[model samples]
Target chain A: MAIKHQQPDLVPLFIRYVGAVSSKLSRIHGIAGRDLEIKLGNDGVIVQIGINAEYSHKVVPDGERWTSEWGVTYEGMRGISQPVDHPLKEPDVSGYIWPDPHKPERMAEIKQAMARYHSDYAVMVDLSCTFLEAGYAHLRGMEKFMMDLHLSRDFACQVLDGLNTYYTALGVHAIEQGIDIIRIGDDIAGQNGMLVPPKLWRELVKPRMESMIHAFRKANPNIIVKYHSCGDFSAIIPDLIDLGVDFIGTMQPCGQQVDMAAIKAKYGDKLAFLGGLDTQQLLPNGSPEEVREAVKDVLRSYAPGGGYVFMPGHYVNLDVPLENVWALLSAVHDYRRYPLNFD
Target chain B: MEISTQDGERSMAEIMKSGTLEKLAQAVLEGAAEDAKRLTEKALSESLPPNTVLVEGLSAGMTVVGGLFRRNEMFIPEVLLSARAMRFGMEVLRPLLAETGAKPVGKVILGTVAGDLHDIGKDIVHMMLEGAGFQVFNLGINVEAHKFIEAFQEHKAPVIALSALLSTTMPQQKAVIEAFEKAGLRGEVKILIGGAPVTQEYADKIGADGFAPDAASAVLKAKELLGIS
Candidate 1:
């Protein structure tokens, strides 16, 4: 209902924690994973599939190095795996073998999550690092990939085409399975602005994304398309709307995104927002009272029109204190009640 | 001998009048690597000083790029291409510059600090610094404090730039500063820190010499720190 721009009993909530933070919370609450998410108050359950699931999110001991199915080597650090070695060292993808997307094991977790949580909660199939990020952060190194985009346009197109083909097939299958939302996440922006120029993104990544979205929509017209990027991608918000993105998230409140009320007022009619809380400074360093006040501020800014979901700008990393986490939850409970009362 | 010297001076004057150096600058500004290299070769063939080609041609072009970047008229990709053009010119002039003992504008030791693996921003800073004539020893990512100290001990570069992309890894900047202080080398160098989550306030808090928000400003900050005009 909130996604459709209508008021609900309360504003929808979907808070995510990194693996380390989740373990820390689990130790205290004696619960883990989806149950802990529900206990902490999340209206949705995210089941990440594909490369992000198989590699990036998988936690290992700090400094331990391993290679993914795609042959990208990563070193585990601070609960997240950072890609250390890219498989495609050069622009040529002809010699590279893409990981099989049709493997039955890829959908195992998605199936289990659907069977368990689909009845009560909104299930989101997260296909993050989907395009540009997959190319830069995983397949090819950042510098080489960026230069390829400029100096070797055809080779860059070949790389994006490979990713589009792989993810489109996987996403279509997930849509056919009746997931409520298909989140296509790419970190194509930085804290300042879009990492790639808006024109270049439109020329290269946008059409491929449109085709992926078109395929998914064809599979299930009712499926909501959510877009996620870590930084200030406000320049492409209108483009995302044109591409049929129903929800956008992690509105990181930096650069031009500092004004949450303005953002809500501008795009509230067309797009629902999932995150606006400042996780970098406020959540990690702010007092519990400050956390609560900020939560109320976010609720007041975004929850009034019913096109908002409450979450931090990014995952609640280990840096965030346990008290801040509780304060966030408690404040959301206090202020999330609809009909808009911040007085 | 006097006649040959006079004749060489006349030809050099004619070359300058014909705007060969201006063409090299334009090539770099346009990010046309082939044109930059060809123009550089033409300047060298005409017996222009290597430093003349570097300062008036390549660095002059980069100076404009830096200004446009600061004013938001240009962005990362365009600046990167400009940097690439500058590098192609530099590649042709490097051995000659070395043989002549022509010093860089300054020396810089740079890297992403310990526990921070992100290097795209740092790499951009590296290119911009080089375009400005700094001989930079980039130590790559996840560099420990001791490694920075070791590189400083070897290179004796007067400036050190640190980058940290995550708030969690930002403390490592302070650790590097403290490491220098402990090694009694704190007074010997200026430390300029930057990255996504970095700010002037944070730099002051961490006892850094300066802070720049972006790569373009990073070049300006380094020049300011080294007292380079």
Candidate 2:
């Protein structure tokens, strides 16, 4: 099991499922889709197919609309184009919006494709990448997406609400499929505290997201809901806990003001924590002992309560050393325990 | 908590310089606003100069709280409540200090840079700077580069801080800096940058005088950049 049950000798190795990559599959699972690339333009329709389906047209059912042979042209796609409110923007129509799972054959095709990317230790689910962020990226472009949330809040809210609805539905379906943890990853903060004022966030995004979380909890109490927002969100721990989040994901130590010891001390009983390693500076820049020392300090603080799981702060960046990854995993597997102490 | 004064009849200044003032500071840092007001009133009744009450009592208290902020010992809400207590104390002193021309320790211009609309960080910076005795001119969010230059000229601020939470809006920092340069006011003022993607290295690369990862460091950087030591 990914989560530790008894006093085990080592931590269970677990890999978080990142979203589907359109790139080449390493032959672990057979390629299911003929056209592999999924692309969204300024228009509304999204086009996804196996590598061979690039030239072929297939009719698919999208939410309320039947989109046949999803168009590649800018105009053929139609959802909120060019982000609703900001200038200097374009909109992405092609973020992960679940295709109609009601259609058995279509759902089967997607499942087959997802199976190609599945792992034994991890269930594939990065639920944090929402259609709203994509819409903002399309409207304002990726560069100003964060700022536009501040500049054009109403529009941001509109996009976020739509994305939240989509995500909640997808999460429910994924849960029914026996996924253990839903990896909801979003960069609400980069290296500082927060991108949007907490007030603004509470006004627009928080209420809807919180509702979704509440609904998820009511649906399945045991399925862990893991959330990741980078940087210093020390102000919002109470809010996250109140919203029924089961696990806090990607606890970056370098950016933001999250002190692992303090957070563990404060919220360990209510929420499990994952990913406290300093992937930004340490994993990419530091040596083996540095990784071990940092890991030890985190273990001392967080592992004592038995609610902590280990992973890098975010994705193990492509630049991170495989040795560093091994060292980090080794320390967790070897040293982490309920009575963890490092005097 | 009632604060005990030194000996029996020490001067208000002396009492302020001792543990009595630190106690009042602790009250504010803990967000004990009622105790903060009562203790501050006692200091004033004891004939503490309003400025001394601020510098020694409130500012000193806030400085300790701000230290917790910088060390990650305290979070934003904790710092914010303390700042609120400091503001209440300042309100008690502002009118009296006006007679002394005890101009704010310095003047700072703060805003969410052009295209960026987030202001929690900017607001916290404003509160901290005001508590630290610098007058702050907040430009709200999505402030254009020209507005900053205009505020600088108007406020004659010695330091200008730019905030951007988005990588896209980060370029606005450069535009604001260029605005200062265009008005022949670049060297006359210090420029500081902060936000999610902003780094000390990026701040230096962009020609900002300093970069702070959080609001507490912003104050420390403010004092350092202005050579206020």
TM-score of each: 0.95, 0.53
TM-score of 1: 0.95
Q: Cα deviation in Å at residue A87, candidate 2? A: 26
lDDT of 2 by residue, B33-152 (tens): 667777788787776767777787888887787777666566554566677677777777778789777878888999998656566678778887777878899988778899998898
Candidate whose DockQ is highest: 1
**What value does the lDDT take at residue A281 in candidate 2?**
58
Residues B39-140, model 1: lDDT tens digits: 999888877889888888998888887777665566666777888899899999999999999999999999999889999889888988887889999999
DockQ agreement of candidate 2 with the native complex: 0.05
lDDT of 2 by residue, A17-58 (tens): 112221122132344233221110000111122211221222
Task: Write one digit per residue (lDDT tens) for candidate 1, span A133-175.
Answer: 8888888888778778889899999989988999999998888
- The list of candidate 1 runs beyond 4 A from truth reads B1-18, B71-73
Model 2 lDDT on a 0 to 1 scale: 0.62
